[model samples]
Target chain A: MSPAPTRRWWAAALAVTLVGLVAGAGVALSGRALLVVTTTRLPVALAVGGLALGAAVLGVGALRARRAAALAVALAGAEDAGRADERARHRRFLARLDHELKNPVTAIRAAAAGLPPGDDPAAVRAHATLDAQAGRLAHLVADLRKLAELETQPIEQEDVDVAQVVRDAVDDVCAQAAAGGRPAPAVRITLPTVPWPLPHVRGDVDLLYLAVVNLVGNAVKFSPPGTPVEVRGSDEDGAVVVEVADSGPGIPDDEVGVVFDELARGRDARGTPGSGLGLALVRVVAERHGGRATLRSRVGHGTVVRLLLPAGAAR
Target chain B: MRDPAHVLLVDDEQAILDGLAPFLERSGLRVSTAGDGAQALTAHAAQPADILVCDVLMPRLDGRSLVRRLRADGDWTPVVLLTQVGESYERSAALEEGADDYLNKPFDPQELLARVRAVLRRAVPGQPSLAAASTLVSGDLQVDRAARRVLLAGVPVALTPRASLLLDYLMTHPGELLTRERLLSALWGFESMVTTRAVDHRIAEIRRALGDDPAAPRFVETVPHAGYRFCGPVTRGVPTSGPRT
Candidate 1:
């Protein structure tokens, strides 16, 4: 059997007390009245019932408030934990960056210091290896640091020329394409011939360029030497729309949305060098500028990436 | 005229400036510095620099504002931004503000130097003239840079912005190895996540577009552990499609 309800138990006990009190008072106030007991019972019964109802209502309201408070506390704790974890991760990443920067300098210094004139071919190869590794580490660290910084700051905003941004991106990747012996993708800038400062955007110029650099760089990396990467931009929906379309293999449908999360990597794709924070960084930067980054792809066809920033906000 | 490019470097970290300036100067460039945006502007006005190398974040007016202010003045000096963060937002902002180039922090001195040289070369007048062999070709395929057109088999193939750039690079240096890092940085405009397999995807797409077999590629050959290479021969004026291996 269920335990007696606390409310009911209390009500019964209080009713007995009230009845006894009223009966006693009636006996004292009225000397020897025959109907006194009956009269006392009625008043006592009403008092007990009203008190029980008021207590129950108050208890329920308090319980609800307590639960809401607990939830708020839990959420605050989670946010704090997230911030701390991010800090620790950032420190490690920066440490890695420092090590990377020092590696190249160490190598060059060591090689220059160690190698006597007329060193053997093997020694030369060793030096070259050190140099190459140093360069690699440097690049990796730089990329990581960039990813981290983009996550943390307010990018400076200004009136920037979108078309120029495209041209600059191509130029930046040219050396890489040449080094790979991959053909540089063809560029066709189709902005209005009459340029008017190309739309002033409010954002961090360096960060924006890097974001575009990453897109163009990725295109060059994945595309075959002779295939093309199409870059197109226009003012759409009151925002500046920049799209980088590549003939390369497209992202899988399921992985598109999550590609922007921190350290997210695609399934079926592996063995490439990166910290997996690139897209996450891109998303952070885009949102900071009051813009957005999106991706679309078909398995056999290719991938197209769109970055949208509010148009007049560029000023 | 200043023979050496005068550069104003803005960074909150004193050590970064201390280490960078000497290294840059050693590369035969004159370097100046600012701790923040306000200082950067004052210094910039005091002595107009040929180029600017500023960090993305700083106190009292960060690097972005510095670039914008300079551009607003119609100075048009080339600027290369530096950053600790790898986000596209910062990169996009820098580009919009008339920045010529950008480099992520913890970069190689050599890579930074190369970029500096590239930017400065473009800024300086008449360097394009020194590029006597500017027209790059591969297997009778040619690109007329001045006209901004690409031709294959005596016909011009309309290419999108990215394709043209890819072709341009391939034609410029026909037989060298290029790594994925280099290509991604140049094309995508930002260094992407390290785990991305996008490079392979892009290569496949390019091969398909070029009608080349991955098994036996002709114009573009994959150099495992290295990068991609263009393997065709060409004459400047002739327009011929690259051979399928």
Candidate 2:
């Protein structure tokens, strides 16, 4: 029931009141001068009855409205409180898990180093594999905790040059690939400069750098030897958009939806050496900076990932 | 800070101490262990270490506070902080709080050793650390990286973004001959030594912007079909607090 009576109720009450008035008048007409005083008294009685009925209807509606409104507010408040508690618990749990894993990871690495030197080829492979796996595990744990921390952590606000970030990330990726004895993919950069130059992004520099590095690094990872990766930066309606495209095998259609989920790995990424949290971290950092990470792929053609941020949004 | 440097390693995790202490000692250095920051303080008071490689987020006291305490007491010992988080604000804050350098955890032990050695070697009584230097100065030319603007003879000079980055790369590796192939891979992300024309173009642009004649190079020197190098002297310093242009 609402706080106010419906129009139908008001209409019915008006009809009832009018009928009572007419009935009272009819009684007066039917009666003689000797009953005039009784007729007037009877009309007053009908009006008083009408007022009492209207008051009763309004009183019930007001009570029900109060109760319903209070219930809604309580439920909403409880839900918010529950969500906050859950997030806090999740963060603390991840931190503790990271802390606990670091010790064992370090110990495993040490134990791997102390593996006895031997002439068996299998033994040598085991030694290197153990050490590498331990290190990878350590990185995975750190990244898991970092993603959670980035969710609620306060980030810095600085004038960031995306071009500079892209240049640096590309440089680092190429250098790393060369060091690993793999053919580094050639990267072509296209950025807007004619239209008053590309506007500086108001964001955290390190976070932005992380996004570009992940984007370029992933592109390089899946690209074939001697293929070129393209990075295009442009201004869109006062917002900045960076697109990194690669000539690698595009992700399968069925596996595309979950690639950005935390610790998600696509079928095509089976043999890739990654922590499987790069895209997730990039998305989180994008959200934290009032932007978004998007992807489009054609399975056989390639994949294009875009990171868009609105200008002047330094939040 | 001394030969056969003494390293004080502090952490709440015994496994780290157990694993790293022996490795470090095997590398020919003295090591002392502390369970927490308080114990570290007592140990430091008893016998000062030449270098302190400690983890942040320790019990009893934390790494940043320990650094502050040491700095307050006029102890300028080189300190390297290790942490599990990679927050940018916290990274800058750690350096500003007087830490010589900080490394994120899950790092290679070899890398940690390299950092320790590098920090120790560069710990000149009052010079700024590597990460803290936001500006690079070469005779009559100043590049404020934080500001992303360059100055020549105290006057701001306008250069394209690519040229500016090239200048920065050259300035950072001053006097080191950077071949065209190397520059292309480092600056252009090229895989092979494929036609190094792009490198020569950018170098020419930067040279023109800086008013340097190829015959008599003041900033960038050509190596006659080999490569290029920034022959100017370079120094690291803190940037003036702003964008001056």
* Best-matching candidate per DockQ: 2
Q: What is the C-alpha lDDT profile of model 1 across B1-245, one tens digit per residue?
A: 65888888777777667667777777789999888889988898899887788777688887778767776676677777774222334323433565666665555666667777766764544222111233546654566644556655546665544455555555544554556666666544345343223344456645665666866876778888777776665334522343222
**In angstroms, how far off is B210's CA in candidate 2?**
11
Which residue ranges in model 1 land beyond 4 Å of their true spot?
A1-113, A117-119, A170-199, A225-228, A234-238, A253-281, B1-245
lDDT tens digits by residue: candidate 2, A1-315: 232545555688799999999988887898755434445577799998899999898977875677788778888899999978986887788888877776677666655654454789998888778877887786676568667877887776767888887787788788888878988679998887795666778877657777888899999998887888999988889788889999999988887787777778888888987778888878887888899999988887889999998776767
CA displacement after TM-score superposition, residue A208 of candidate 2 (Å): 5.4
Ten-residue region with minimum lDDT total, candidate 2 chain A: A1-10
How does candidate 1 score on lDDT? 0.64
Name the runs in model 2 displaced over 4 angstroms: A1-94, A110-123, A142-254, A296-308, A311-314, B1-3, B84-97, B124-245
